[model samples]
Target: MQTYPTGVAAKATGTPLTTLQRYLQRSHITLQPCDVPSRGCGENRGYSQRRIIQIALTTELARLGIGPSRAAKAAFEFSDKGNTGRPVGELYPLGQTLLVGLPDGKSVVINIPPDKSISDVLSNDSAAFICDCGYVVAKVLSNLSKS
Candidate 1:
């Protein structure tokens, strides 16, 4: 498995290094370590690509109002809900995108269709505000589609 240094993960995920480190220290995530030699000539710790992606995804989700803890739990639930073998991308239009910023000083652009029902688009445990956004958007789209 590929691993990413703290900096690389921070850049890729649009998260600040300090925040990432705090999350790591809090045991909010498990990261894969890199194999590169330590630049400080001391103990080196690295993070895995999987962990980086998870962090990035979680961060992005939180920006959409899903708290970290709840986001983690929802991820597992969503994965299981999709066990019917249908890809999520296939279920929703891929081109619809949204730009979001997290409280942790991270920003990301994600693709999420305007057509998906609010209930289908967000995790059950998602923040109430997140569901509200989906509901508001869905209503707007429904009106537009009827025209």
Candidate 2:
């Protein structure tokens, strides 16, 4: 198994330390005390390599606009349902326009003004669906990285 210190993981993944903490907290990954003290701190707390990867993947998902809750849910779902089957399509009726796409494909919408954000047209459920899609994509990327 590959191992990485928290600092190294943060640097490699381009994730802030605080964001990593939030993801770890949300994901409920286990951690351990560091054998060596960190710089400018007397405490010795460190995250495991698996935890770092999990946090990094979560951060990347959230960066794509998926919130922590949905990210965790989607990550769990993807882990259980490996991407070996055909894609699933979903349609979102946003006001007068309709957006349609497969879960892992780019969305196509019709009759929406170019200046408006998609969030403006979507209801809370639709927004959540979009967030879940982002998380699924992140999970796929994470799995690819492991191979």
For lDDT, the strongest prediction is 1
* Tens digit per residue, CA lDDT, model 1, 15-104: 778877776677665432433434687656665543544566556566776667655334322222232333421222343433233344
Q: Tell me the deviation in Å of residue 34 in model 2.
A: 17
Model 2 regions lying over 4 Å from their true place: 27-51, 76-147
Per-model TM-score on C-alpha atoms: 0.47, 0.39
RMSD of each: 11.6, 11.6
Candidate 1 Cα misplacement greater than 4 A, ranges: 32-43, 75-147
Per-residue lDDT for 119 in model 2? Answer: 58
lDDT of each: 0.46, 0.44
Worst 10 residues of 1 by lDDT: 127-136
Candidate 1 CA-lDDT value: 0.46
